[model samples]
Target: MERIELVKSIEANAERILEDFTEILQYLRSEGSDRCDEVQNLLFATRRMVDLIDSALEIYHYLIRLKYLTADTQRSETAESRDRDKMLEEMFRELNSNLGV
Candidate 1:
């Protein structure tokens, strides 16, 4: 209900999405690249989406930090950056499994 709590919830959800994205991307590169043009194109699109998301989140975090540091708000939470190269070792639902990995 509070502002901080809402941001925390969003951050938690984003973490899960990031994890899934990383797993799916890795699987595609490892075993799906040679499948066909469709898979390759899809993978490229997904990667671009993820990159954009990361950049946007980073900017969001920076703006938040700036506002709080400038005494604009009492609620200040640092958006801890996730490791870009991290991998999720959990099983992910097959993304168009028939197409490839």
Candidate 2:
């Protein structure tokens, strides 16, 4: 898909995940019952969605580095850009280490 569409999809998915959390909070506050296990499952789902969002952000960064941010943007990435990429890689490494993934 096109970059803009992909970005929009990512944004929407993030929003949906947030909404799911909100719903979970609402349910817990109002109908706190034997649904604790369900709420826990929802939390796990939220975490997975967060991981997917991070992956999407990484893809977006790569696309931006590829000079696909705009049709007229022919500028080269700087050393800071590479540094940012390294930082993101390290972040993912730490995340995976924590998850044993």
Highest lDDT: which candidate? 2
User: What tens digits encode model 1's per-residue C-alpha lDDT throughout 3-99?
Assistant: 5654665676567567757765665556543558657757775876676577557657755665565553433322222222222222232443545
Positional deviation of residue 80's Cα in model 1 after best superposition, in angstroms: 32
User: Which model scores highest in TM-score?
Assistant: 1
Locate the minimum summed-lDDT window of 10 residues in model 1.
Answer: 77-86
- Check candidate 2 and list the clashing pairs: none
Give TM-scores for every candidate, taking all chains together and pairing residue i with residue i.
0.36, 0.35
**Candidate 2 residue-pair clash tally:** 0
Candidate 1: residue 10 lDDT (0-100): 60
lDDT of each model, Cα atoms only?
0.57, 0.65
